[model samples]
Target chain A: MKAQRIASLTFTALAIAYLAGAFFIKEPPLRQQLGPDAFPKTIGVMMLVLSLLYVRIEFQRQPVKEDDERAAIIGAEEKLSDYVDYKTIGIMLALMLGYGLAFESLGYPLATFLMFMAGIYVLDLKHWKRDLIIAIIASFGIYFLFRYALRVNLPIGVLKFLFR
Target chain B: MDIWNNIVLGFSVAVTPFNLFLAFVGVFLGTVIGVLPGIGPMTGIALLIPITFGLPPNSAIILMAGIYYGAMYGGSTTSILVNAPGESSSVVTCIDGFEMAKKGRAGPALAAAAIGSFIAGTFATIMLMILGPAIAQFALNFGPPEYFALMFAGLTVVTSLAGRSLVKALLATTIGLAISTIGIDLQSGVSRYTFGNLEMLDGLEFLVVAIGLFALSEVLANLADMRQAVMERLSIKGGLWLTKEDWKRAIPAFIRGTLSGFFVGGLAGAGAAVASFVSYGIEKSTGKHKEELGHGAIEGVAGPEAANNAAAGGAMIHLLCLGIPGSGTTAIMLGALLMLGLQPGPLLFQQQPDFVWGLIASMYIGNVMLLVLNLPLVGMWVKILDIPLYLLVLFIILFSFLGVYTVNNSVQDLLLMVGFGIIGYILRRLDIPAAPIILAMVLGDLMEQALRQSLIISDGSLGIFVTRPISLILLILAAISITNPYWGQLGAFFRRIFGQKTAA
Candidate 1:
């Protein structure tokens, strides 16, 4: 069943590829009859033929039995407690969003410090004071490395007034 | 005398303080990225491509090349320690190296791998230094039809070994080709597959597709099964030195693997993965520790490691000589070259000899640096893995976003990056191999341009590819390889005539 689903998806993707190629292309001059459209059209045609072949071959095979039990087993393996670790997607997303928002507004030194702090905090770092100190130092160090040494064009952010 | 002078000139450019530093950075970051499961040299180099864009072309190539070599060394680390391989080339290492780690012989296993890699790498580097120009000259004869045939053969070979339905891989390849069309046509400057979006007019960057498909999908897959992967034997114990018996057993396998890999990986273009598997198979069939094969044989680690590194060297053959990347990692490197507006081929050797030769020389220097880097730096890599997964993922996503956005400072690119991530996840869930898709996309444009150019030169005759001696030989080899496996009885008959026996 999963294989069948995947096969269908591939077919759809190929169709999109073909449609895009055929619709968007233009004709070339007689001297250059192939034009920009020729390669794309060829690939699209190849995909269309291949997708039909795939559907034919797969549909002829015995349909895979969808097992609710197997799905249950997989779900059971993913305990909510395990999903709550520092590796959780939610935490990662939050940290990234925060970093993105803060970086340009808070200046490199301060923003990087906060981002590092948030990064370790999301990692469940218990030593808050130590984390704060290390984050500030590392942030400043990286900022200096990129900005001063490498001459990178890092954002100075809107916090220049406070630092000044 | 001219060649010697060129070599001296290449060395002078390559050994500059900045280029040397860039080389070190590339390899160092490559090794780290390679150690991560589901990440490989392609992604490592892809991420670095943008970073190098602002630099000089030679410096950019040097950095990208370092990442390629560094990733090779880094791939073995995960296999040796965690029983997971980020790249196909390192998969065989997991068999013996992981078993050795389980049995408290991690040190010897790692030592053998390091030594074997150094030996094979040094040997292959020497071969590259001597044979590169000749091979480049030979490949100069490849015309459009020949290149198309070569790419077709590569596609077939990759699909054949894709570990699933060949039809699916072919489908994926076509889909990638289709995606390659989704922007302004290079020749006519007309839009294709834009769905009316201006961002699609530029077509999708292979970099975005590669990162989304490999890195983002990998993260999602890992997220779905986070429990099993949280921690797998956190600490590894054993000295970092190899014993006498370990050395004695590993040395022969190393030599055999190097030669075997250089030949197979060079001609078949199957890359390091096949080389590693073939080496492991040979060691098991012929070595004294046949019984100990899966149970932590030192020969297993040494042979595959040598094969993989030698294959890395051999893979460079296609890249330098023919301008075709034999493996996924090299494809990313090729993409980098294209973005730099430098076409890769025999012309590259002639037009940019300093750039080409200097890049090659940097590889030799980079390999030595990687050996020194990996030996004492094992602990650092181990600690890196232990960093909080959320934080790690967070930084990866953040940096990726920042990197893409900063390139053009456009939010549209970021949205495209996210969209590609979704597509990547979908492809992964379907078990479609991302490698072929990216390969097709990377080479598709160039192949198209070449085809058109050749036709113009030939006044619309298809005989140009067939008339070239070199191209004909390649096409014949491709045909034979494709048919050889199907004609089992014929193969057996020929083997018997030659006094050779078939394996059961």
Candidate 2:
């Protein structure tokens, strides 16, 4: 499917899913008439309408010579979509999440070092030695800046033994 | 007596050696990043926010404001040099700016943009100094219903002007309002969307959402292509003087653009981008040299550059006066102000006169400093743009992480920043405008609180919005504001029918 159609359908699905979840929100006993659910309920409905409108516009845009026209449009859209570099982006995202989780356990310096190395590798830069050195300097540099200069604490984790 | 004393107090705060240093640093850095392709004032401000984390509110705002107009001035450099607008606000400058550069007129073009921006910035700052205090005094008379109506009107204006489609803007606004309802209900004290998590109870930090949505998402979008701006090394040496004929065309445009940009940008949601675009169209129509516009017209760079800078100054007025941010960048500024535990509204003028006046005074100084910074440092600005995109992207991500962490000190906030980054990237792919979402998010709490309070006063009566004169006037303005989107289409439809009748 073309990205336009796929995007429209995705919003439609999102709106429906949001509304479905809205129904299960347990209100406080004897809440105000315009209760906590009112705003969300309005938003869900509006999202559904807007998404369907978007989908309608997309469909209405297609001519009767649908197959060939759609193929051409999809071809152009696919060319655009290929720019995302999804493999690298996915790796970058995964590394970030992992780094976030490991931040408390492995410490800011260590986790940032590993994350930066993994991130640079994912982006297809091959100067691993330089990257590692740079990453080490950066991680420690930022850790000290936040800890001392800015007076914010970054958890030291198991490295506290060595530093102390 | 009051205005004079206020100015004195403000100048006193701003003229301090420490504050002067802060303003210089802001403008200097703002100009450097603003010259970079694909990085405008918005992203520049977001990335550097952590630098101001430990500073007092007055100095912090002074620095951010300097960066704003500094970037506004810098955006034109990219347009002239590389035909790339660092931000949408400077998009119009590329039309004639690059043509002039190609014709070996880059020096005059750059000088015109800088000088026009300085003049407009000074003019607009004066207007802000006048209008900001006046508006705050007027708003002091407002009640809860009026406040609610004013916020609603703001959203209405934004929805009409900011988005390409009203439905899309509405959807974005509603989603933002919904997100604001996530934590414990302000009125009823019941958690709406917390879903029984301890972390969810206190609510999402605005800074986390901002860094995620604006800074991180921009990195992802740029990384998709990674096309660094290829700049040809060219000497910026040339006469700074506009030719006799050039000044004849440009001076009037500078004046007109300054006025139009100030008013348009001072309105809710219509920021520098809209102001410059509107100024471009107006400049074209008002000129006998319309033929010269697309072909290296100095007026083109003069008008749009001045308009953009003026708009930056104009945007600050509404934010400082009413606490309702007039544009997306100011909305982020509002969030920063909130984080500092300072409320910006009518009472702010009365309460913290020094802070308010000092910020105003700093704008005057910053505009002069930007002119000094840009005119002599063109070579340095050009070199700053030589930094590779991949390196900048990495630094952007790293700074965003630091900023989000600084705000909440939670690993969860970092993850949420990534989460919002991905979501923001998807929204961009879908052709959804992000400004409305951010604007609504910033306004959401105050909007809801005002509404509930008005309702409580009226025993849940919605008519209270219409009964109050101020509220009624605001609601009427909102209704009129929506006509902006459809006015052109409506005019054309009527013209078709009327033209047939006239021909018969």
State which candidate has the highest TM-score.
Answer: 2
Off by over 4 Å in 1: A6-10, A20-24, A29-31, A62-149, A152-164, B1-4, B234-238, B461-464, B467-469, B476-504
> Candidate 2 lDDT, tens digit per residue, B313-401?
88887788888887778888887888888889988898999989999899899999988888777777877777767667777777787
DockQ of 1: 0.25
Angstrom error at residue B175, model 1: 1.9
Instruction: Write the residue-wise lDDT of candidate 1 on B172-221 in tens digits.
Output: 77777777767887777777778788777888877777766666655555
Model 2: per-residue Cα lDDT at residue B112: 87
Evaluate chain B of model 1: give its TM-score: 0.91
Docking class of 1: acceptable
Each model's total of backbone clashes: 1, 0
